[model samples]
Target: MCYIYSRLFMFFSLLLLSFSVYLIILDFVYIIEYIFIIFNSVNITYIILIDWMSMMFMSFVLFISSMVIYYSEEYMNGDLNKNRFILMVIMFVISMMLMIISPNLISILLGWDGLGLVSYCLVIYYQNIKSFSAGMLTALSNRVGDVALLMSIAWMMNYGSWNFMFYLDIMKNDWIMELISYLVVLAAMTKSAQIPFSSWLPAAMAAPTPVSSLVHSSTLVTAGVYLLIRFNYAFSSSLMNFLLFISSMTMFMSGLGANFENDLKKIIALSTLSQLGLMMSILSLGAYKLAFFHLLIHALFKALLFMCAGSIIHSLSNCQDIRCMGGLVKQLPLTCTYFNICNWSLCGIPFMSGFYSKDLIVEFMSMNILNIYIYFIFYISIGLTVAYSFRLTYYSLSGDFNFISMNLLKENNIMLLGMSGLIFIVIISGSVFNWLMFDTLIFICLPILMKFMTLLVIMLGMLFGYELSKFNLVYNLLSKNFYSFFFSSMWNIPILSTLGVNYIPVKMGALLMIFDRGWFEFYGGQNLSLLLKKFTLLQLLSLNHLKIYFLMLLIWIIYLLVQI
Candidate 1:
């Protein structure tokens, strides 16, 4: 049995390896496509090859999926769920691949929904109540975004046919085009977990570490920014500027939340959201190339960080609360090493991946048509980013190793080696991609100054954090249910007044609800004894039900009646 199991495992491992090679080949093909388009040798629309952004995205997905597949051999240790987990991982990769290559709106929506569904399953793979609840929250949040996409699709079909080839042609209708663009931005915001939709991301930390690393850092959360990049030409200037403001706000707010988080996973979760917000802000400026460039760097280092966190948790037998962790640097040296590399990159230190990408974003903000105040927002967010990165690195790895028992410090070289490789890549990513696009004076020097300023802020924040640890004031304020409070407060407003009295459906909703519920129950409960009474009432309502029961009943009932 052991021999058979080993053989089967080796076979599957080789299959995953082969897939990784195929993905690398695909990445090269995408690069060639970009070159072709750049020189006008091939029309960008005619070509079906993946673009640069998608290629980078696929590379991260392939790397992380391969790592997870290999790591699962030891991590699962003959558990029954091993097969199920592997299957989900493969499905996750396939969905992400579909998402990357999808060329049109309908295809993109299909891939997007597929990814959301698969990610939810992976999150709830352990069957724990908390995990299940987290998955549901993710699903609910994603569904809201899905509805916006559907509305955009409806608008598209109404203006043109179901054919996406008509998109460019339909652009002549400015109002319709702008409306579709607004809906698309709304959809992207929800999917990317910006502002009001951001709560689901931190909640998603309830999933297993591997799931978190893949979904939170590399693939799922990126879908929003990907959409924004894909449809860059559709949005109006006003809408783009609005998106820029919202994304910058999300970046700052999420970084603040990360600074206050106690759980290891929640900190990374918020950081992922913040980094994505930064990417979206760049995308909103029509800087698609730079946004994607930053996305590639962010994915690599963030995945490395999450995987290192996973290794730490696994070594300590699933302990993830950072407050309980002290000195782990000595005990988990390999993990700590990778964590530091990721932190350096995330903090935008010199010669790191984030320095190149983040500096470009700041440069773009400064040089773009945006106001100086907007640039200031981006600048302050950089400090917040550094502060949170330091908070994560210091509290988890630097304090004292004596806090964790010696017996719990088992090292898995496979996991450690995987993370180390990612860290090495993150260190050299700038040179590998030629991401340094600006002047040395502006890009390197200014960012270094910014980095030091940010570092000082981080140190001060840590000291304040230490003091607040005693009084628990900052911790409590950060942890307060701000999202819940704001949502509840918004709900308390009179919808009719807020939306305009003309927009309100009026009190007729209660009458309809009573009628529909009573009618359904009455008809459903009828038997021979009450059949006559039920039939008489049903006949009276049949005229009304006629509109609901036709071949196009749903459309008329939902659209026409709602409008009325």
Candidate 2:
């Protein structure tokens, strides 16, 4: 069953890939616009904007989803309901496609809602307590974005249409439109799991790895980036400037969290969050095209990275804690190779897929005279990325074997087949994207110091990670102090997001329950039932005699005769 679905997705991906190639060759933007008139002066229009960007993004989504589907066959081989998993993944891909091609807010909302709901379904597929909690968090957090989108749609009604693309130019100067922009930004932030909403992302890792690979890495999270890209024109206001600060903080926070995290999947989840922050921050800087560039490139390697992690987990008896993983290179040589390639690419190693975009993003930021705070945050986050990568590598791959001796760690052929397809993309996607997106490549002139700053900080981070891993200095220091628990637990974001986001509302609900069960139930329902029962008992016991009925009838008759 899984094979059939996987192959079907692969076939569809191929079709989309071929269509993308044809569109690229023609170098033409095609718009198929249709309007359905329901009544007088009332119509819902459908705009299918087929441009190079949309086609390319759609192709990538389908391709990665296909690979993920194929990978899940082996990874989820033992599951009784793998077919359901495939169906959910397929539904997710369809939603992402709907999002990619639409310029209309209504269509975007449909797609956006689909993504959120499908993701929640996937997250809770395990049917366990952990999965249920994670699913709730994921669903509610994304519901914020859904509500924001709905509000934006309502606000757009002021213009008598939900075609936001048409209004992007006119809406820029209008304060009312500014409200819509703010709503959109908030929506994007939640979809992308920025800051407070970020707790759902790591918690979502309770899902199967194949889901984490496709949804978290490439499709669902990037929906926010795509939204910003579509609405880039509306973001030239103070709201966007404020968004830049928030995004910067989010980026820094996620990177810092990744450095302290020990769970292998959660660390990767944090990295995804940090990269999202980078994309959001860049978009806030009005570098929307550059942000899109990073989005695409990040998707490629990140998906591959997650699959590699999945493969590792599969071989290691499903243990995801890096503390219990080491010397995997010797056991699963092929998987380790893929893991290292993806990991290095993630750290933005030169010439890899990540480098082309990440380096350019940094240089672009450096070229602009920004506030010192933004500058520091950008560089420090980059350094932190490298630091965590180093720490993860050291703990999981380089150290002595932490797994049980009897554990078998052979590479699964089916999983490798799926990974091999992604490896090709991860290698050439950066260069291909650079050529396609930029007609004339962007060249930024930076001071020599600034030019080398990214590499220098990365190197410093590597040193820091290696030393910290070898000496146990950071662990010891943190364990002994207040900062240790805070950093390790991602500043208690998971606790605060779950307990904080839900606590007050849940408490209020409990109070409401008490009111309903105690006062309302007793007085409104139980008392009424008791009073009826007593009345029925009195009628049966006291009024059952025929003499009573006859006496009442005679009194009624005498009163009627006197009135006559």
Candidate 3:
């Protein structure tokens, strides 16, 4: 079942990948529209937009899913529910495809809801307490976006159609339309795991590694960024600027969190969160294509990174802690090679797929007349990204062997085969995509020092990474302090988002439950029923009094008759 599914998906992925290239070459868009529903003058339509952008996204999603399933076949070989896992993956991809191909708000909502539902299922795939908690976090966090999308859909009714693509140009001028844009942005923020919504991304790592690769790389997290990209026309300058700040903060937070994170999958998940912030930041600068560019490249390397991580965990008997892993570059050279390359790309090392996107994004941001604070935050975030990447490399791939010496680690054949498919693309896809997507290069004139600043920060970050990863008395002492706690916990975002976002609502729900179960139950149920019972008793007593009066009258009449 796994073999057939994986092979069929691979063939379709390749076919779609090539066809997206074809669509780009031809510069064609094919829209299929059906009148889903109509009322009076409104013609509600179900629309499928086939263009290079959508096609490219579809191909990337399929390619990654194909690889993930192939990897999972080996990774999940012992599991009884491997087929179910594979099917869930297929459902995830289909949900994503529905979002990617549809321009209609309603269709997007259908897809959007599907993503939230299916992701919840995937996250809780493991039958454990942690999985259950993680899945709830994932579901509820995304439910915010679902509500936002639904609101946007409701707001679009004023525009006379659910096909939002046709009305983007007018959304900025009309106040109501501006409201819609804000709603969409809110939805995007939650979906992409921005700020308060960011906690779910790492928590979602409770799922299997293959699902992690797919979710982190393309389907779930990217859904928000893609939505914002499609709705780029609707954003006012203010909303864009707001998104810029939120995304930058998210980038900084996640990068810092990853440096202190020990769990290998969670660290990768945090890094994915960090990259998403970069993507959102670029999009806010009106570089939707560039954001999309970053998104695709990220999807490629991130998937490979997860697959390699899966292989590592599989070899290590399902161990996920980087602290317990070290010097694996020698024992598992091929897997580590893939891991390092993906990490380097993630770090935006030159000639890497990530370099093409990050370098361009940074340069583009530099050219703009932005506030110094935004600039500082952006560059600092970039530096932090490098720092964490190096820190992760230091712990996971280098240093002395930290694991049990008896364990013999070897790569799985199917895992290697799956990973190999994405390796070539991760290396070369950036240049190819940059060439195809941007026909004419963007001209940027920045000073040399600023141009070199990115590299400088990279070096500094690497040095800091070394210092940070070093184990010593002072380091150990500091590790016990508040700073470590703050950074490691993603500024306590998970706690705040879960307890914080839920604090008021959960309290309100409890309050409401009190009303429902305590006051309401008393008044609406028990008390009312008790009062009715008393009223029935009173009526029965009145009848008894009448019967006694009648009996007394009958006795008096009998006595009078006997006296006569």
lDDT per residue as tens, model 2, 1-564: 666766776677677667777777788878787877568767767888888778778877877887888899999999998788888898898899899998889988778999999999999999999999999999999999999999988888889677787889876898878899899988988999887777888889988999999977678899988998899898766877788888888888888878767789999999999899999888888888889889888888899899999999888888988888988888888888888888888888889889999999999998887889999999999988998999999998887998788888888899999999889889998988788777676989988999999999889888987877787665766666767677767678889877877789988997678566786676677778887877785566575678777887999999999999
Model 3: residues with Cα > 4 Å off, grouped in runs? 35-45, 502-564
Better by lDDT, candidate 2 or 1: 2
**Best model per lDDT:** 3
How well is each residue in 4-105 modelled by candidate 1, as lDDT tens digits? 433444455355445545555454444221322544453433224444445556666676656656665666664787777777877777787777776666
Clashing pairs in 1: 326-400, 327-400, 327-401
Of candidates 3 and 1, the better by TM-score: 3
> What number of clashing residue pairs does each candidate have, in the order they appear?
3, 0, 0
| TM-score per candidate | 0.73, 0.89, 0.89
Ranking by lDDT: 3, 2, 1
What lDDT does model 3 reach? Answer: 0.88
* Pairs that clash in candidate 2: none
- Residue 504 CA error for candidate 2 (Å)? 3.0
Ranking by TM-score: 3, 2, 1
